[model samples]
Target: MNATQRTNERPGIEKNRIIRIENGKKAYLPLLLLADEQEDMIDRYLERGEMFVLEDGDRALAGVVVSDEGDGVLEIKNLAVIPAHQKKGLGRRMIGFIADRYRDRFHTLLVGTGDSPMTVPFYEKCGFARSHVVKDFFLDNYDHPIIEDGVRLRDMIYFKKSI
Candidate 1:
């Protein structure tokens, strides 16, 4: 994997152009689960310095909310590729870009998820496997339960890869 260390320090909290998202806009509701009806917490993470955005072509296509737990663990708190662009390998391409850019630097990469059919499979297809599950994940962490197609979620799954 090719790794580039841009001498520039990463953007600062106030200068971050990327914002955290709890969900895509309303029209995208069917494609993802809204972690909360109110997006404040996610916004705060963005403002406090923990989110990363990926762009393809001229538009932003995906993001990953990450927290550095240790030099060995980089947690991908959230990840999504807009529904309009699914199934075209854009998601895979972005993941490859990020993994290539960070694999040698970080010992491992982690991704977490609440109960969601679409997201779980997407992660699996990207070469992730279930590492563990946290009960009441959404209840304990999110202000509201994530519901999609009227199904409520209460657990979160973790996926990991050695980069």
Candidate 2:
């Protein structure tokens, strides 16, 4: 795929552009950290995952990292939109782009995120269903407490969507 491509014509989403980052994935660390928090955890999959960024001219509005997890499964390791651009349908558009682009190659799209009120609903709204849970994922993996939407995160909630 090209490094940059125009998104499909969807009301309120046509103006955005999604770029595939072929190098320097670390350059977007600030945005990546918004979703995953810890750098080390992101490092675990950063090099292996394919990254795409939603941008408006020179500014990166959002980004996502997806890795093929074998057996026709593609996993979203990180996804984040800038605070100023959140809830504007950018993240949803990114997800839609990924699904459309990989529909032929992958059977399922998976994302494992903290059990936070803020994130789970967004995935659910984007057509993902609760698949499984890894208890104490935050406690066990993170060096510090991971909290979101006023809730202390403990488990890693996995969500799945069939492409």
lDDT (0 to 1) per candidate:
0.61, 0.92
lDDT score, candidate 1, position 4: 57
Worst 10 residues of 2 by lDDT: 1-10
RMSD of each: 10.3, 7.0
TM-score to true structure, per model: 0.68, 0.90
In candidate 2, position 163 carries an lDDT of 92
State the lDDT at 60 in candidate 2. 93
The CA lDDT at 142 in model 2 is 93
lDDT tens digits, residues 127-158, model 1?
88889998997777777667865778788789
Model 2, span 28-127: residue lDDT tens = 9999999988999999999999999987766899999999999999999999999999999999999999999999999999999888778989999999
- Identify the candidate with maximal lDDT: 2
TM value for model 1? 0.68
